[model samples]
Target: MRVALWLAAEVGEGGRFVKQQLREAMPGVEQIDRRMRDLRPAGWAIMTYRDRAGLAPGELLLEKIGLPVWEKEHRSAGLRVITASTRRKVFERDGNRCIRCGILAGEIYPDETEVSARLTVGHVEAHKYGAPSGEENLVTECSRCNETAKHLAAPRFDERQVWDEITELPRKDKQAVLAWMAAGKREPSRVERVMSHVWQLPGVQREEIFRKLGRSLS
Candidate 1:
């Protein structure tokens, strides 16, 4: 599990830094890829670096394991990775701001175990939108902030409707919207593809679409 989490967090990202980290975990590139794929069973999903979808459940387990007893810990709990460059570049763009409320990375990622840091990158839109996997669309965030951000981005969400709530959405989601506005594209689907449409629906209505998933509960 430890090896899988570290490797997934790093390899699944698909960037030079993450690649380097994965390589360190497994000396061979092929080995690293295989290891990342293994995380699927544990609930890890290789996410786009641009949004708050990177925190696959499997990786969450790993994050819990990766905490340093002396430093604040953050788990990439629910984000996506459009591209490895997206994560690295976004981290560079906002100077690593906490996606939720613009807190600095150092503040969240501080080297204090007692203090928890919820730092993670968030995508402006979920990858289901097929949003651009580019540098102009990524942001840094703390985990708590990111999770709340991801949750708020759900269902009939409109930034204009709630300014305070917008902060709750992932930084990546904000970046994605910004890119869309900059490009003059109003097709919300184009911004986040159908994800914007899904956001338009209430959480209950959306979750009901997954009725097939209920079979597992049976």
Candidate 2:
């Protein structure tokens, strides 16, 4: 609410601001950027340099004001509290991997090997415009993708390059890719599904299962 008020009264529509100003205004408020981001769901049009050209890094533009959440009647506007059960269901449905990037929980990122991926639930659609918190609307996402998606930023990969790579795939792989695109989420292969399940077992049980599988293969 304070962030909304500050943006509206201080920054005004189409005004440019920076992180330092926000910190100065809110002084010691934890996750001020996150607080500002929460307003996006309520119709606020805050734009970063990625969304708007000519702005330097760390600068932001308040393009429009959103819901008056401070008012009693609109306090809960554009926000939905997801239940714990729904989170569990979404994680299970996504095979405990990031549906967008296919990174498993605690796995190191392919690009940034030093950093491990952490899973979180995010809307399959843009949650900023009031996407529901139901299992159907949710999917497991890595922390990196979740932040990027919420900001409505351009994807890290080039579209033409991605398409070119996709076109070069073998016929069976192409078909699998097509299936994943049609479903809006990748279906883990049988082996991957089994591995996901195995990851959930106790350490000793997992070792026993792996040993039995090795014996069978032998």
Candidate 3:
């Protein structure tokens, strides 16, 4: 709310601002950039260098202001509260792995070894205004993906290139891919499901199972 107020009162629509200004304005507030980005879902149109070629590396353009989140009636605007049950169901449905990146909860990111992935529920159509919290509309996502996905623009892939790659796959693989596409989600194979469950076990138990599986294979 403070972020919204600061943006409105200090930097009105069509105004340019920088992170330093926001940090100085909201002293001791953590993740000010993230808080500002949160406004995007509420119809805010903030453009960065990536979005606006004119913007400098450190600058932001407040193209438009969104809901009056500071106001009492609009305080919760653009935010969806997922129920505990819904979260559980969504996690289960996604095999407790991030649907976008396939990183399991507590697993170390392949690129960021120091960071362990944390799972969160996120909307499939996050950019859509008023996207629902229904199970069909939700997917399990890693925290990193959840935070960065909205900021990243869609990848530019040629339709023919994608189709050619798909066509290059074996017939069985092509069928599986088609099935996944039709379902709107890729179903985890039985081994992937079992591995996801195993990843949830205590470290010692997981190691023990790993060793047992290795011995059985031998």
**Among all candidates shown, the one with the greatest TM-score:** 2
lDDT agreement of model 3 with the native: 0.78
Against the unseen true structure, what C-alpha lDDT does each candidate score?
Answer: 0.47, 0.77, 0.78
Q: Write down the lDDT that model 2 would get.
A: 0.77
Q: For model 3, how does the per-residue alpha-carbon lDDT over 84-195 read when each residue is reduced to its tens digit? A: 7988999988888888767888898886545678787777887465677689988998766765566543454678988999999999999988787677555788998797
Give the distance in Å from residue 56's predicted Cα in candidate 1 to where it truly belongs: 19
Specify the poorest-scoring 10-residue window by lDDT in model 1: 63-72
**What digit string (tens of lDDT, one per residue) describes model 2 on residues 66-131?**
788777666676345566687788887777899877889889888774567878778777764456
- Candidate 3: residue 27 lDDT (0-100): 94
Order of the predicted models by lDDT, top scorer first: 3, 2, 1
RMSD of 3: 6.1
